[model samples]
Target: MIASNSRAELMQSGLNLIGQALSIFDSDLRLAVANRQYQAMFGLPDNLCLPGTYFEDTIRHMVLRGEYGPQDDPDEAVRIRVEQARTFQPHYLERQRPDGSWISVEGAPLSQGGWIAVYTDITETKRQETLLRARSEELSEQVLENAERLAAANRELAATITALQETKRVVTETQARTRQVTEMIPAHIAHMDRDYRYVFSNRQMPQVFPGTRPDIVGLTGDQVLGTTTFAVVRPYMDLALAGRHQVFEMTHEESGRRIRIALTPDRAGNGVYILSTDVTAEVEVREALTHASRRELAAKITSGLAHDFGNLLTVILGLQDRLTHAGLPLEAHADVQATLAAARRGVELLERIGQIAAPQGTALAPIRLQDLLRDVVEMAKATVGGSARLTLNADLPKERLMLDPGHVQDSLLNMILNARDAMGPKGGEITLSARAAAPWLELEIADTGPGFSPEALSRATEPFFSTKQGQGSGLGLAMVFDQAKLAGGTLRLSNREDGPGARARLRLPLRPVRPQMVLLAEDDSELRKMLRQMLIRLGHSVIEAASLAEAQGLADLPGLTVILSDLQLGDGLGSELATPSGPPLILMTALPPGDPLRDSATGPVLNKPFDAATLAAAFTQVTHD
Candidate 1:
């Protein structure tokens, strides 16, 4: 503390030695600090020179002493100076005092809520300028008047230049701030000229639509967005340039992301302002909500009916059991048996209805297509048996996507089973292929079986409409359709135009995660280091924080791709650091899957001791969603 005091005194002494006057005022309008030259230059009294002196008092003193030259109302003059000081922005001006001295005053606001002013005595400079002007009188009257006019003009120009410089400074600052804000937004904000070339961008095009270059200024829309996507948006862009503002959505093909785009015409009609945001997650949430609402309504409609039907089936089964036990003629017994089979089928149909009406909520997570397909194949092999073969043809750049693994597996499995049934005992091959369809993951299941009839084609997806007659419930395709719609996807059935077989196509929204800069927060030093290295190997830049506080401190750092943190930190739960507004977050933990901390996390979770691939896949899933 003593050493700090000595340093402060030394700093004050050095400031006082400067030839010009300097004073700093606090936000409360009192002198916080002043150098010795400030008092000497202003001829201020001792009390006014000390810290805590009110700025108004100092100004009033100067006014009374006529330092600002003769004024009709001294109080009013003092009031003006005090008021101006209250709103002190950076300024520079030279004024002559009543004592025939000139001083140039420059004042600027401090970052911490106050103002600091520097006053330089320019008496000699002003005197020299005056002498130079006086010497011009040697010329004739006309020349002297012209010379005076020129001098006046030069003064005005200097003042105008100063004002222009200030204006330019402010405009530059504002533009910089605007750029910062736009870049920080999780969208692309840009402008395109009449020629359809980008004139400016906020460097977020890649974030909104991955694989697009960020430095896209001077690039045409087609050049930046590729042919297919550009074609989709060309009409909208044209309309905007024609003075029609538009807002629409499109699937960005390159990244498989759903984007909401807004275009507004410039006032001059020479350009359009564009805003495109990735709305994949929002669309998913909306679809889930819609599906939930439908389920609720369906439940309301089916609850009582299902109960009555279940009871009737139970009674029929009991009566059939008694009839079978009480022997009758063989033909009569066969008919009773047939009736029992039909009743059993009705029971199965009721179960199917229940499954459809109360469909489970989708638990979306990052899943690799290859792994999911492998699982599906394993599950379907038993159902397909030796008579038929299931082949997978997967051509996808990145296998990871945000999806409900269970729902997708179930849907695909159902399709496989349906294809098997369609092939009958002769059993032909079933091919399942996965590929990208731009903003959608397309899974095509084709069977080398008799194609659907015209009537079947029209109502294949309808509930209880089956070609298998009494052998099929007809709800298989319907259930697949429901799953796809619930997942913001589509399911379509058609005859394979290339061959004598049926084809079922499923298209689900694909959100592939990209590499990102990760903030890794973990209390264990070894674990943090290990995770950081793993992330680096996975092509992500990692910033490490030991606790929640440290992570929060680094949260505002720019270019953070995501936050990967441990569930438990030195300070508190790392989940507290998660926010809705910024990059995606993934929580890592050793807790069991059922643990509240793990189960409750809304973001992705990586179990402890995960490998590089697992970490990368988790990040990809979270970011893509």
Candidate 2:
């Protein structure tokens, strides 16, 4: 693209190299383009030489300066010339200027709604022609006339060629600009011919699908997309080739991303234009919204039933109590008591159902993720017992995140139990893992059992949709989905790629605990200012320190978040602040990872030249005491 621009600039430079002054004006008589020679020849101001300058303005300036010799009415002359230019035509002409010099004006209309005019000084040529006519008696009147006409024709042809070249350049630039605009769109734009070969591409395919090639023009679909992906898209490609446009979505196995694709069939040719967008995040939000809608619908349906059922249970309980008190046979008394117990159980169940149906606000509080995961593991193991073995993989940086631990634990337990049931009586291994996919905390549980069926995959999160064959309430996953959406998160269901198992992924926003005050320590004044701003941008009040000694003194200040200091400070080592007795410390270092000083730091390390995001991450990386 840079090369293309450079070549375009070079072409403009080439235009100025011509001796003849040239200018192209659009149909509206506004200057479309002009060469340097044109400005120089007319001695026009820069603004007049620029594109969008009115042709009338240039003509008026010339007329007022007496360039066309004395005019009785300069404005009238300008108006007449402007009107003539409005209906411009191809022509060739020579006229003597007020300076007593002759020049030729040859013009041709452009194909794309414009006309190009070229001006060349013809004083020397005209003088020679006059000399020939006066000095040579052999020269006939007819011969002189022919000679002049030939010269004029040659000049017109040269002007026509120059106009065509400018027209081509304009068209190329327009196309380049259009292509640039298309590239800016956050989607893969491409064109495929009837042979399933990419003929044009905007180089966004690799971004949409992680492993795909970017320069895909002239490559076959399978070659660029790989066998698996091409297979998924071939059916749609066939439909597009059959002249039917299509818009659909498919999960990319390689990247584990969801992409929405639109194929537009060319009306003039057997080709298809493809626009594919990586809509993974968008799909997650859509699913969250869909789950919320279903929950709303479930609440609406359950509200009335619960009300009626509660009143009916009350009537049954009253009768059972009456029977228990009244004189009756011993066996009959046992039956009355059993009936009373069943009625009470029904009332309790109704209350639990109501709690599930009603919306609940999120309890946002600072909590350690490691503590949360430990509690989840302990609870899950007690339930799983010997039914299945449990494995936990937690890869996380030290950080305090905001979450509702109770609700989150309940959701995890639900998923674990479901995985246990799916394993059946024979039992299987259940692996639970947690990691930061940034912007999201991803908690996943997988089991060594048959994966979810197609029907189950599509309807699993819907209320009253279950796969337990009447043994379950079908609301476990629904509740999990509800909890996620309430906290601005999402739940995804998939099969494990490595083996036969089901995977339930819960993603929550990775919001770390934001402190009220942050202490920043750096030796350099410039870097210190930058770090202070970063802390302020993260909504934390900052206290500055120029050395480790200064940082240690302020580290114990009340309400301090942490001491963010450079490892190699002027006075002392920043590593000393990482002591258990001091506040949480995060070290920023320019030293490489292999350097002993960097590796020896007893806190999270932030490499030098980091941005706002890195600073935010560093805050999360601090291990709270």
Candidate 3:
């Protein structure tokens, strides 16, 4: 009986210990004698296990309110222990607290239909789990961040590589362009070091100087050029190397070529750039132009001398003509006649001199070829009479061409007259014909006379050059040559293939005709009257102005084709007549070359003591149609 009492005390002690442990059981379950641990595990109040309360109703309330197990299956081990009053499989129900603690529940079945779940505090275990989870998340984020950094670095590397390739391409293209520009230059270019060794040269260097080859780029000039070209360039090179730039013109004796070279010092005077240009053609052209200018000046001076001499001879001859005509004894008459003949010869000689110096011919105009030829034939027929037959073969096209009518007539007359002289009283046929060639009007004057010798034909048009002696002035053909030039035409003397005499072929350019008027600006009283008489004889209206002031005062005067002025005038020959009118002028001057009077007149000039025919022809030239 004492042992049975000890067993009952032992059971009571066990119950007391369980009740003090927890409070999670229902009030009804508690009143029905549930363990305190169960009440504490379920978070039940102290009266939750009351006897009148239904166990099923309390458990249903806990289930509905989520106070049951996380796995709320009615048949689960925890649910079976709470409702069926059976032993449950031991499960640690993890419970979390706000202060980071964990409670583990180990449920056990009671005698009544309820569960007695044990409550255990596991704060350190849950804290360890949270730290582990947080550490794991941090590690994953770090891995993502590292990957992003790697991607950014790779992008930057790609950008750097692209930039490097673009720079390479730009450099390559710039080099190519530089090469092209270098080759395009016409001059030779080279670079040299302070040691006088060639570092680089343009493409033209090899061909420019034959003896010096640029293949020896690394060699000094003395070694590569074999001391010839180098000796010429060494002084300049030394100067450049000493920091002074050198520029010079060089003539290559072997090639007879001129070269212009420039040596420019480089930075720090360590090297130099050499540039050379071939100026052989340019130098030659300049020299030729200078020679031409000298010749032209000499020609003008010679012409002026001839003009003054002609004037002196004219005065002498005119006085002799008047004196020789006076009556005298028979013996003296012959001498006087000889003197007159000599004076006449002197006049002809002076005319020849004028022709040689400044040959004046017929005026220029655009005329129908047929009309010009017909006029020549008519005039020739009058001159030749019935001795020689004059015929005109009008085969010319209906086109106008530039010519001087009087000069052309004179040219035709000369040909016909020469033919008549060659006929030697037997007479001969002279045929004047014209035709139109592209860009020219060709006039052919063929005569049936004795053909000329090769010697006579060769110098036919030379000044003071003639076929006839004693009877001709020797300026006829020369006059023809001058007329052809003045009219912008070409003249040729050739033997007639079908005849024995010669053929004079004249071709004038086809151009529009210009209308011209004469402005006779003569200041001398006697000379002005003489010119007016001559010009009137040539069918020109003479508008006579006594002085430069009178000429300028003629406000109603029409524009003129030509101006004829006396250089030594009462008020000075009008420069206005030349500049303002812009007409071709013939100023008659008694002054020589370098004379201030001659220089003052701003127009093409002629010397005084001109013949009547000469003045008439000059007048007609400026007034040509």
Q: State which candidate has the highest TM-score.
A: 2
- Please give the distance, in angstroms, between residue 536's alpha carbon in candidate 3 and its true position after superposition: 25
Task: Report, for every candidate in turn, its global Cα lDDT versus the true structure.
Answer: 0.80, 0.80, 0.63
How many residue pairs clash in each candidate at the backbone level? 0, 0, 24
If ranked by lDDT, best first, what sequence of candidates would result? 2, 1, 3
Return the lDDT, model 1, position 29: 75
- lDDT per residue for candidate 2 within 220-297, as digits (tens), equals 999999988999999998998888989999987545578999999976454898999999888887876776677667
Better of 1 and 3 by TM-score: 1
- Give the per-residue lDDT of model 3 (tens digit) for 234-336: 8998899888989998765344457888999976455888998888778656644553454355457557775776677678767666766776667886776
- Predicted candidate 1 versus true structure: per-residue lDDT over 1-625, tens digit per residue: 4584575577677667666787878665767678899999988999898655678899989888878877899989988888888786889999988778898888878654467777878786676566557765564565566657667856765674465345334434544576788899988999887878887789899898888899886689989989888999999999999999999998764555689999999765658999998998897677557656655665666796888888999999999989998988899899999999999998888877777777656566656778889889988999897899999999886645667788888889989988898899999999999987677889989999997889987677666678887788777887787788777777767898688899998998877755687898999998888888877666668889999999999987999878988988888988887787877788888999888777877777788887765676677566655
Off by over 4 Å in 2: 1-160, 180-188, 193-199, 202-235, 238-243, 251-258, 267-271, 277-293, 311-349, 514-625
Q: Which ten residues in a row have the lowest lDDT in candidate 3?
A: 19-28
Which candidate do you rate higher for TM-score, 1 or 2? 2
Model 1, position 514: C-alpha lDDT score: 57
